[model samples]
Target: MATKRVAADVPVVRVDGRELRPGQSFQGIEYRGKDKDGNDVWRILVYAGDKWVETPDGKRKRVVKTDKHTFTGTFRDAKKFKAKLEAERQDGTYTPPSKETVAGYLREWLDTTARRALRPSTHAIYEVNVNKHIIPALGHIRLQKLDSNTIDRFYSSLEDKLSPATIMKIHTILLSALSKAKADGIIKQNPAKNATPPRVEDPEITVLTQEQLDRLLETAKGTRIYALLYTLAYTGLRLGEALQLRWSDVDLDRGVLYVLHKTKTKSSIRAVSLDDDVVAVLRQHKEEQDEIKEIEGERYQDMGLVFATERGTPPSPSNLRNRYLYPLCAKAGVPRINFHALRHTHASLLMAANVHPKIISERLGHASIETTADRYQHLFPTLQAEALEQYKEYRRKHGKGG
Candidate 1:
């Protein structure tokens, strides 16, 4: 007689040993026996893939499979575990992991999922970090073996070699990849869950003072990049956004510019109200562009870009920075910040003038007002102080003070 009766429902689990590789035999437990405590326990068996082993030891150890796994112990905990395993199998969202390494999984994940899901530039960045940083550092480790402690040590080693910002980017890619692995059931848990990456240091925003702005603009007068740089300063436009502007998007009479195209983010699409002075500068720029177009005749590439070279092509950002903006900044004796500082200068001037963050966010084409506040959080306390002072004066006049 059988020692114990098998239950109709059990979680079928497969835990294989190493002997299956050579094709001489296979090794695993067949869920068909009872332990000394009268609870069912698994028994080991060998197979040749689909065929059962007929050797004396194999036959003695073997038992039949009925799509059920052995279970024992207290009714509650065992039932819960069995249900979970069965649910996972039925849903097909997960499976037992085969022999795979972390590097192999990450490469496949990037190629199959991240490459198409992320934006082109973002994918390029992920590719660089994965291929250069992550795979090289921990590729040999098995997916199951990776742990938060290992990742923490890796981050610690990189502390002195990479900036906090770059390290954070690398960590973000690893976390994302590992997260996908967990979701796919390739691993039981994501090792990066509790991993500590270097905290990103707040970047020092380079905002040009009013005096510096005056000098830089004055120095840029009559220079090729004057209009481009001036528009950025006056309108709080990001460098890439300013470069992508077109004539049709500008409404000089109404003093408005439609941001129909942005080089970086689609969320930045919105209309921006331009200052009267900025409109005048753009008008002058348009006239100059026409003159250049006439001079170049058929050779000019008229793609309608607002900021372009004499040949009507959009000027390379690096070329414009090195050949023009930097030299002008040096001549003006300013901090010599890059073209992006002009956008910062614009936002700072607005804040100094007591403009609201929502308005600044719109002008700068930021994705959200929170982005503006976070980027300029250091300036916000000063704004609060100024407002309180104004409130105090109002209260004094109303009756509180002589």
Candidate 2:
């Protein structure tokens, strides 16, 4: 009887043909290898065209040269390769997230929430806070794993590294992000909800004394930055609001300046009475702008801004601060403070002058009367003194002596 053949019993290479030419082809079944146990591991027949071919034999395997220049070689056993390919297909190991970073999420949140619910300028501020501060610190951290302890550590680092107001802004950004995360189910709860932000001490405000104000005005005469300083001091308009102001908003005939729009706060949309000093400064400033327009002829772009660059674009906050406000303060020999501090100085001086808190709130366009009282309460006399004065006044006016 003929002996049966097993795959491992065969050698690695075999062939049926004896010799090969330059341009012919052949077919064969090739066995890749066998398991530990010797077995005839068979695969489907393979056709080779002009390639080196592995031919299987009962006792030996051999490489054969075909008629063509190269012959195709096929594996007779493919259990291992098949298993690996199926496993790789099942694993599915190559995909990326829809949103990748905190900065990215913040931008999406601003587009979706802040833009829809808040003012455009308010949304712009949130974008500034995210880009300038928050993204640099913790943007790489995954939103889902952001815990209260992580936020606490971030706030602690900011308190030591940055200004109090900057830290407060960072806290505000984190709170807003985490609140959105909770709403979207990215996190179970807001980590920043109960997180204690760093307590910010109010910085000292620089208010010009009457002597200092008079001296500064005298020094600012004949300069382009003069009326801007006067408007900041007298009307308490923020830098952007002042820059956005048009001649139409100013009713010189009615002696009232209408703050119909603002860039700082949403509440800053009301009218303010123009006192004599403010009116006089505006008149002079208008005359200067008109002269410039006459000199430039039609080349000048006229937006009618109360405060604008000579070329007619709006004045940038930093440009106004550095080039105008700072030099003016230095020249006038007054202590330098930020343009924002001008607003605070206006409020503080009003409180010192015993202006009613309600009126001060209205002038500053505060959302609530309590906001004004809370900010300026320290400058006022004690509550007891106020109560005693009220009682005395009431008695003097209404009490009848027997």
Candidate 3:
């Protein structure tokens, strides 16, 4: 049934044995019939004060603004909401109802604020989440109509189809986008702050032992991606970081790599030292690349990427995974692991060798040593025992043992 505005002459409506009337907080509360479940629905009216509006002739006129919020709960609930609306209006953070759909706003946000502010890869991720997941579920709803309850329900609906980690990523996108909308005064507040998302526990990290690493490298010895895999094992560079490396970024003489772009954080944009073996491997790879460039002549892309396809074009991750990584792991008889496992293998091996955690942190480009310690906390006790054993060995050598 449609709801009509309550006139001043209407009889008082008794709610919970209390007579309700217009007061400082609300102008009136109307009983808008029961909902589908037979619960009384009350529409609370509040004075939203005055606002300057433009007329058809382009002249500004001051007009009184009023707000009606429909609530499907007890009388106390309606009163509380009325108070909240009045407070929002007084503070100038009240968002009037708008017809802007969630999909329209999110797509605009992705094209404008997110494009210039986020890295290209990050922007692509946002675009995918908005189009593939978020928009399909909640895009048709008005921007201002989005509430915490709606978001909570949406997250629950995705539980069967997506992993908790993937759902968490979706939550992050929504929270970030809605926070921007709030900051821009498009919404009164961020509803995402109150919505609950699934908790994602850190997965077990898999790394190869020295023997396994040897077998994997041996299997990749003569392959085109050999140098890239070798660099990952020796330097612990991320797959993206290693793939995007340029000839200018690598210093063979100094045995160092300058990571300038596509990094996860500001701390990731640091210099990483290379092992002598890895440096030599890169030198040979460079020679091989130069010969290919001469053979291909003008067909070569000349992007200067250190790890590229035969035509000097950047290699896709899928190609690296499907064509090389999987086959090499199978042939080498090692456990099939993703590219990131090589980075873990490198870090774990260094820690096993009694290298300082600070050095490991810097090498891995971690934001802080604490991050390294937390990530590899499982290995510290053994390292500590080894340190004590070394102390005993030193004492024995000096003839000061107990």
Among all candidates shown, the one with the greatest TM-score: 3
Model 2 alpha-carbon drift over 4 Å, by segment = 1-103, 115-125, 263-266, 348-354, 382-402
Considering TM-score, which of the candidate structures 2 and 3 is the better prediction for this target?
Answer: 3
- Can you write out model 2's per-residue Cα lDDT over 1-402, one digit (the tens) per residue? 012344555433333432222122223323433344533333322222234445555444445422111112323224343344335335642111223466677778877887887667677888887887777877887665567787788788777678878778778877877788666655556878877887888866566766777777788887778898788877777776787899999988778887876444667888988888789889888988988888877777888888877766677788767887788889889888777777777887776666788888988888889988887666667544866797999999889971
| Model 1 / residue 109 / CA error / Å | 4.1
Q: How well does each candidate superpose onto the true structure, as a TM-score? A: 0.72, 0.65, 0.83
lDDT per residue (tens digit) for residues 228-332 in model 1? 888988987777778788988888999999887734577688888988888889999899989999999999999999999889887888899889888888899
Worst 10 residues of 2 by lDDT: 67-76
Candidate 2: give its CA RMSD in angstroms: 16.2
Model 3 / residue 73 / CA error / Å: 6.7
Report how far off residue 144 is in candidate 3 (Å): 2.8
Best candidate, lDDT-wise? 3
Where does the lowest 10-residue lDDT sum fall in candidate 1? 18-27
The whole-model lDDT of each prediction reads: 0.77, 0.68, 0.87
Tell me the TM-score of model 3. 0.83
Stretches of model 1 off by over 4 angstroms after superposition: 1-94, 99-112, 142-145, 262-267, 296-299, 367-370, 395-402
